[model samples]
Target: MQYWRKPLDADKIQVPHGEIHIVRDRCKGCGFCVEYCPRDVLELSKQFNIKGYHPPEAVLPEACVHCQLCEMLCPEFAIFVTLREEVETIES
Candidate 1:
């Protein structure tokens, strides 16, 4: 299961960036997302959600490769990642 795949044309990708959304109420505090994150982007937050469970926090948003490993591993389907717009540099 490859989440992030680099294109053959390296120049197409400008910079790595993405956003993670965690549905707090749906989280069971299983720590799956935090543990499976390849980049250690997520952490179990100190704050508890409505269900009285700790949800995942994007501690390292910039480090996230948007792999979606967290989403796949989460049994509760509490988290997902969305890729940010690429800031492509026009080659002069």
Candidate 2:
């Protein structure tokens, strides 16, 4: 949750903007992200996968707080969160 508010240096990290990759086959739909994420970006899908379990879906990209808890907690390692600078506005 706190990481979302922190700014990352471009030289340190280079990743895509607001991109969260979720693999359906790998997801177990445990809803751990749903429980851990403060921003509530992930949600349980109604449809079931081949494994007979509902996978987690990124319903809102903007709502992601970039906490990385989803990535850490995922037992199947199905989620990826990449951070990138969307703008170059100087804050005073």
Query: Cα lDDT for residue 51, model 2?
Result: 95
Q: What's the lDDT for candidate 2?
A: 0.73
Off by over 4 Å in 1: 1-15, 87-92
Clashing pairs in 1: none
lDDT string, candidate 2, 1-92, tens digits = 22445465534553334568888888888888877876778889899988999998888886564568888898889887877566322221
Q: Which lDDT value does model 1 have at 3?
A: 34
lDDT, candidate 1, 1-92, per-residue tens: 12365456656645445688888999999998888888899999999899898898989887776677887899998898888775442231
- The best candidate by lDDT is 1
In model 2, what are the clashing residue pairs, if there are any? none
lDDT of all the models against the reference?
0.79, 0.73
TM-score winner among the candidates? 1
Superposing every Cα of model 2 onto the true structure, what RMSD results? 5.6
Cα lDDT for residue 46, candidate 1: 98
